[model samples]
Target: MAVFWIQPATFLAAYYHYFHGYGELIASHAADPSYEVALPGLCQPLRIRDFPSFLVDTTGGEVGKLVNDAFRELFEFMDEQGHGAKFLVNTFDELEPAALAAMRRYLDVFAIGPLVGSSAEARIHLFDHAGADKKRYMEWLGAQPDMSVVYVSFGSIWTYSKQQMEEIAQGLRQCGRPYLLVVRKDGRQEDVSSCLDDAVLKGQGMVVEWCDQPAVLAHPSVGCFVTHCGWNSTLEAMALGVPVVAAPSMFDQPTNAYLIEQCVAGVRGERNGNGVFAGAELARCVELVMGSGARAVEIREGVEALKGMAREAAVSGGRADRNLRSFVTDTTIH
Candidate 1:
């Protein structure tokens, strides 16, 4: 089975105990271990905010109810046997070492990813966008100076309200840097051209329905990323050595945003009490990441360090490769 993170894996373990009548097994294991296993608390304290909200308090509107119900069933399926199931996560050791180590106590967890195409391989896009001109975007990016552009995308899912889109546009404009803004046509109330007509005409930014995200992030012109803090996006930014400006919306995004902050790879944009993005705050975050102040320099250094680690983890005979091989070997033996 595939689980995204260790927090959910812990919940799966609890559900396994409930279904298999292994009452207090986790507690007993924690108190007095029967087997030599990598247990929880072996790592440093995790930032409490870097966890999904549902795990903390699941009391809200329809979305919360749906998430809670879905998790309930997912955990049950994950632990049909007395023991929790093994899971393959799309993450690497350096990105979430503590959580990965802690979850190994109850579940056989493997970290194998940044699972995108290599430099020589073609990327496999899940969605079909037959008309996008890759050459045109790449040429535009090439024309820009090194580390001069801000790339903004909120992933394929997660439709933003019109207000949110306007605020983002305003933020990009206020930052006074060239940017590539992606606003998919299907889920929005206005067309990209009409919404950012003045900005486009002024050559301040380029707005598109979709572009190659991995390619864009890897581009030399991309200085900072303005993202919704999705896991894939976070990993991509880390892998490409681009700093981040997180504007988290929901689910795992908030947690990912918190991790970005903890790693000093980026800064989280501030939102109002109503959870609305402010243009000023977005601009501030972009400046904080891309500007040449002391904090920005520190963040840039941190991101560069993480980029090296990510590359090392994914290379041949690296930690991720060895871990994956061991998992395969153990499975065959079992």
Candidate 2:
């Protein structure tokens, strides 16, 4: 019953319908990524570059092609199975009505989430290092005033490049905000660490190998989350009422970025042609979502509203709770 789709229900619904065109588009993007395509439920037009990297993968690695073929097989099975394929998505009804509705037309879709936080009050992500002490970062957050720190974390999968890390460090410096940055130790981090030394010495930032993301997002000091826009991170920010500076990298991240920005919950950062978001652009996006400007205020308001919706949907009598109950009952009876 617990599905691990990091992609939102909004795009997953369309994946069931427009999957047929994906191959042609992938080939087209490989040739020239200049065109935009309209999806079924999304109002914003998605350019070829925004599609999952696996689909338009030009790396000659063939990993993208292999992943694409595997998805094609699953799609073929779904086409044969139809409503027999039941998916429990982690999202709320109010959050993505159109996308949910579109999905239900093709299969049995349940909106059972925005599964925001855990029951455990002392939740900590298990990290294998000295920074593993949950109190280490939590203490830092406690020292800062409410809404003073900007939290930056790209998810665990992709290794950040030295240049990419430098750009982000420079951007955080430009923002001149007290920011907490997460850098994984999966290799090639010594150079990145060296780049961040100047900023850490200035007392403007803290760089940890890894941190408990849920706990950090929940902290009062975290004003804005500069994320890669992974689905779980997106939902956590929505539920916790933190505005985002979405720096989507690959997979469903681009679509998630688009969703948050279109909903006015955050700002999807503008990237340069090099596929690298520079330090200056990074600062501009952080300011847009975190500062006191009208758009920033509006983004905060939008985030707060979605926060309530996400909470309500997961509560006892809410839509997601009710849907879960219904699903259990039907499965038990059958």
Candidate 3:
């Protein structure tokens, strides 16, 4: 039986870009994980590491098998359907033209998103189960000076290693700015808490179990976002014009980080010898995005420009709006 899975448009584009919109290339490149490739719109060449795990992982396991199966199934379905199958991707046309163009060569693909905007009202309840201290967090944010707070969250799914959490705690201490960090109530709650010294964070930082992420991103005090580079979070941050300090965890994260850097809107936090983001590296990334310098100014300006485009696309008569309406009309007719 064929299984199905969904992927972000940007990440899906990385697949198309690497395969050159052909399945044959995927079969041919099965041997070389180290080979370099480039997408039309991006400047930096990508290796297998920059793509999704299932695309590169040779480690045979049940998880790998399921993901690989789904990937193959997706391609087969697309190929079988040909131009008759319409793909309504949750990405705005202005955001990823190269990827969209690549897919449209064979499929009826529409770039109708960054769809978390008001028009689409994309919402997820994953964070709700965490019992976030919303009142305290919101009040704290309200009290902070404009553009002074650094908001950090790695989405709801991932739980960091104790060492990584310790490194993050240490980095935020050294970050030299007020930061609001979300430590989920998953198994690693104590791991993060144990690493964080209350003395260091006293009156300077706040670590809550959860917060309304969209609200935090939109807050005026939030200047820099330390994110896992999830697509939805990426869009939210971009739309609000908050500069990102990319600490990608998995899947589409690395690609989104690359996208952020390519757009001159952020810097990726460099990993240490252990392939973990060291405390110093985290501090450096935060400084690059939040510091008062030419580069920081440019990054902020870059994200602001993207913010305008994202809002424009969500509004009536915009590309996202038009494409969405067209899809609805076409589907209704069919």
Better of 2 and 3 by TM-score: 2
Return the TM-score for candidate 1, rounded to 2 decimals: 0.83
lDDT tens string, model 3, 1-334? 1111134555776665544453355435645756666655544566655666566655555785686577666767766765667877777777777667766666677677666644212555665544566779889999999999989888878787888888888788888789898877673734555675551466898878777777888889998998888888888888888999998756677777877887787898867757578888888988888889999999988999999988998888999888878877876877
Pairs with backbone N, CA or C atoms under 3 Å apart (clashes), candidate 2: none
TM-score of each: 0.83, 0.90, 0.87
Q: lDDT score of model 1?
A: 0.72
Better of 1 and 3 by TM-score: 3
Off by over 4 Å in 1: 1-49, 56-59, 77-84, 118-126, 190-193
Please report how far candidate 2 places residue 81 from its true position, in Å. 1.4
lDDT of 2 by residue, 1-334 (tens): 2244556776675455447655565456554555676666655566665666566667766776687777777778777765656678888888888888877777677888887665334544444555466787789888888998989888766577788888988898899889998877783544676776765856667888777777798899999999888888899899988999998877778778878976789998877778787899899998998888999999999999998888888888989989888877766765
Per-prediction CA RMSD (Å): 6.4, 2.6, 3.5
Return the TM-score for candidate 3, rounded to 2 decimals: 0.87
The Cα local distance difference test for each model comes to: 0.72, 0.78, 0.74
Clashing pairs in 3: 92-113
Model 1: how far residue 283 lies from native, Å = 0.5
